[model samples]
Target: MTPHNELRLLPWSGPDGKPCFLSTDNTNGHLSRLADNTEAIQLDLATELLDYASVLLNGAETDSEELRALATDLTEALRDTLRVAESRGHRLPPPHTDTHADDTDSPTLPAAAFG
Candidate 1:
């Protein structure tokens, strides 16, 4: 696990390995922000941020408590920023999801080929 400050400098990647911003400052930034507030809302926000970081780090094959916390905080900030942008008419592309062609609708191969 990192000391939390260094974790902020780490980059977060989406499921598609694209970059995403998580915090305005390094891990220290997140710590500093949290230090100023201890409300339930802030704690909840922290949890949400941590969850996002876990997903990002897991996608990039990295995991740690500090990384997770930092990532989560960054993720929350990103989400809020996006929400504000959307409210103002800025749109973001949705996260990528695997969409398989309808193989069930395609003609099936002959079963006799295996026999």
Candidate 2:
């Protein structure tokens, strides 16, 4: 187990396009460096997706196929973003509603919560 402050959680997609988290305490290690690189790429992709979504929302062609494609991309990007937030404990409910008493008792994310 890793202390919350020491662990660096990097969000990424597997080869099959599934969300995955790489945890590391060594911020300067080789794998950690890779995680940093991967995070950059994912962020870029997310930005591109957002730009496209804006275009669609602001009156683009309304073909069903095109809409479906954009919807799929949007879902993927949002899921990636949420996974990143979840790993950082940023999206949890308020403390009053939280069941866990401390950091050590935090609930684990289900595999399906990823891509």
Candidate 3:
């Protein structure tokens, strides 16, 4: 039997927005179930966000508040999805590099590079 100190993925953030890991060895324990439920809710929220976006787009007019709320929901859902991916052992790719650019030279449009 495994000990209770085994680390398990957290379902949500703590009071200060940090991930909270639970130390438990049971595969079917309460914390494990909670994590699974959280992951499912996150994925479902993402799907709901897409549906809401489509509805908003189809409407004749949209208020700024509605748009802002949608954006917030989208961001939270994305973060949750990323957490799920991390728990599954997936990682983000390295930042893209410009092979033509030199190491010592600064980017051409430093102030407006992103655009």
lDDT of 3 by residue, 1-115 (tens): 4432356557588899887887655768887888888889889989988898999979989999999998998898888888887765422334456654466434356666676
TM-score of each candidate structure, all chains considered together: 0.25, 0.58, 0.65
Model 2, position 86: C-alpha lDDT score: 62
CA lDDT scores, all candidates in order: 0.48, 0.69, 0.75
Give the C-alpha miss distance for residue 53 in model 1, angstroms.
11
Give residue 26's error in model 1 in angstroms: 38
Backbone clash count for every predicted candidate, in the order shown? 4, 1, 0
Name the candidate, 1 or 2, with the larger TM-score value: 2
RMSD of each: 18.1, 11.5, 10.4
Q: Give the range of the ten consecutive residues with the poorest summed lDDT in model 1.
A: 1-10
lDDT for position 14 in model 1: 59
* Residue 71 CA displacement from its true place in model 3, Å: 0.6
- As a TM-score, model 2 comes out at 0.58
